[model samples]
Target: YTFGVGLITYLCSKEIYVMEHEYYSGLSIGIMAIVAVKKLGPVIAKWADGEIDKIEGEWKQGREAELKVLADAIEAEKKEQWRA
Candidate 1:
């Protein structure tokens, strides 16, 4: 940036160059970027949270199925032992 400014100053025979227009333009762009992130942050987080909740629910179902299978196996073993 300094090099660009120096080259422009040298070419124009001026110590200061035009920055007012670009500065405000850049500031506005930065502000817009901040606003966009702020507005989207919660919505994106909610979507991610919902996806996480869905995955958790799926894991819970799988865990319940595994527990049921274990319980059934135990019940069958107990019955067989009683018969013996």
Candidate 2:
């Protein structure tokens, strides 16, 4: 949008100059940019949180697998000791 604005500004420089720059184009652009950011912020945050949750779930699964392996080893050791 900024690029498009720059392009329009470049193309209409003479017309804008003739208008004596009375139009609050800069202010309007700023307001629109702010509105866009406000609207997108929550969506971006939600996407980031979803990604973090996926990574956290993978880590949890890995930890659980490691714990199970250790538990099985300990059980086998206990049985060996009993046999001895």
Model 2: lDDT equals 0.88
TM-score of every candidate: 0.63, 0.59
- Predictions in order: lDDT: 0.91, 0.88
| lDDT tens digits, residue span 1-84, model 1 | 999987987856753555567888999999999998999989999999999999999999999999999999999999999999
Candidate 2 wrongly placed segments (more than 4 Å): 1-33
Check candidate 2 and list the clashing pairs: none
Off by over 4 Å in 1: 1-30
Structural RMSD, model 1: 6.1
Most accurate candidate by TM-score: 1
Model 2, position 77, has a per-residue lDDT of 100
Q: How displaced is residue 3 in candidate 2, in Å?
A: 37
lDDT of 2 by residue, 1-84 (tens): 999989789767857544434457876888999998899989999999999999999999999999999999999999999999
